[model samples]
Target chain A: MTEQLVLNYSIAGDDFTKAGEAAADFKTVLKKTGVPPDIIRRAAICMYEGEINMVIHADGGDAEIIIGADKIEIILADRGPGIPDIELAMQEGYTTAPENIRSLGFGAGMGLPNMKRYSDGFDIKSAPGVGTTVKMTIMLPKNRE
Target chain B: MKIREISEILGAEVLCCHELLDTDVHSACGCDLMSDVLAFVKDQSVLLTGLVNLQSIRTADMMDMKCIVFVRGKKPDDAMLNLAVERGIVLLSSPLRMYIACGRLYSAGLAGMSEE
Candidate 1:
């Protein structure tokens, strides 16, 4: 594992049914590459939440995962309408997802918070009419810490 | 508790992966919101919910949950079931409502998520 592995995925807008596909694929790659189970699960959860948020809010986006021996980094870049308030969005129970999305069992205002909860490092950049990019990192366990 | 025990307690019908019923499950969480499930659940192997959608199965998969018990007689459609099958997650359908089902599982020694 001397080299960093990079994986890229494109997400389709409004495709609730296919929301988690990229994260699932990423998890598979992590599993095959022999990442620890707990680290893999954390990465998958963050990726999945971000992936779903992309589909629901940003109308799809690009996901890039960089895996190294020390940590895993996930970048979700979406060109959809950027979030209005980063502070509100980070709040646990605030969401702007429409009723239709709510009907599908998402949009409980937990996506961003959940992603942050699972990742060791979290950063977000967003503008009103531009886009949003989320960078998340989960450190690999050292001595099972 | 074993999945089989959960089935017996909830009187749920195993919809897929019957062979895995004997698998052990440490904790359970019942929520209609997949986002909440992803946020709060840690090392929980069973998801009991009434949300019937593809993401439900996807949520179970991402969390490494072993079984999903659909309460209130809510059953997933064919596509959702197919996804569960692909993920190797066992699906169970129970006529009990969410509260009753959770209560039954709890009374039978099936615990919910531990406080983090």
Candidate 2:
């Protein structure tokens, strides 16, 4: 963790078209850094889902990713309305996104679940009136390191 | 199946990356929902969709899909096509609907991951 390469990105709220730009950029960086393909895919998927969630639910947010030799860590903080119930949000088929978002190919309630599915470690903290922060880590296989 | 074969079968026009026509892909999925495409699809190299947006291309990029077939004659904007070229993804537009395109490819031996 001491010699981590840290990258930061600002996510604009309600910008559906630009939602996944940050994650795409991060994936390119990871590819250039010679991360294993599978590891890169997992990190990219998790980050992309997080990016979409930030656009759909939080209006926008910020993402900080630390790339280490053994593990990659992500911290996404959003100023949008916080989730009142993390448990309900994590359910596989539960979503609070509106119909408009659904037509854009999301809001089936799979974002948070898919994020967790791809990451090795996941944490979510939120207060209704306050904002939300999501932390995730994906560990690289030793042989690939 | 090669991307060219998919194109011929679906009567799709190559919008970009024509040089990649020889690329061989084993599986494909047809859906308008990008999130569903992301969550449920695994190792599918071709995407058949009616949705027209940058997100479709972005989802294909994240999944490392080799080709995208825009069913129902949907056309991506210049920005999307530019991004596809940069990412080396083949873009195709077809007059066929999603169901028919998928059926054609499936009958021609392009498989998809089982939901189970």
- The lDDT for every candidate, in the order shown, is 0.90, 0.90
Q: What lDDT is reached at residue A140 by model 2?
A: 69
lDDT of 2 at B102: 88
- In Å, residue B2's CA in model 2 sits off its true spot by 0.7
Model 2 regions lying over 4 Å from their true place: A143-145
* Model 2's TM-score against the true structure: 0.96
Q: After superposition on all CA atoms, what RMSD does each candidate show versus the true structure?
A: 1.8, 1.5
Task: Give DockQ for candidates 1 onward, in order.
Answer: 0.87, 0.80
Model 2, span B1-116: residue lDDT tens: 89999999999999999999999899988888887887864788998988888889999999999999999998999999999999999999999988888888899899977766
- Report the TM-score of candidate 1, chain A only: 0.95
Q: In angstroms, how far off is B93's CA in candidate 2?
A: 0.8
- Residue B70 of model 2, lDDT score: 96
Tens-digit lDDT track for model 1 on A25-121?
Answer: 9988888877788879889999999998999888899999998878899999999899888998999989999988887888889899989988999
Candidate 2, after superposition: displacement of residue A38 in Å? 1.5
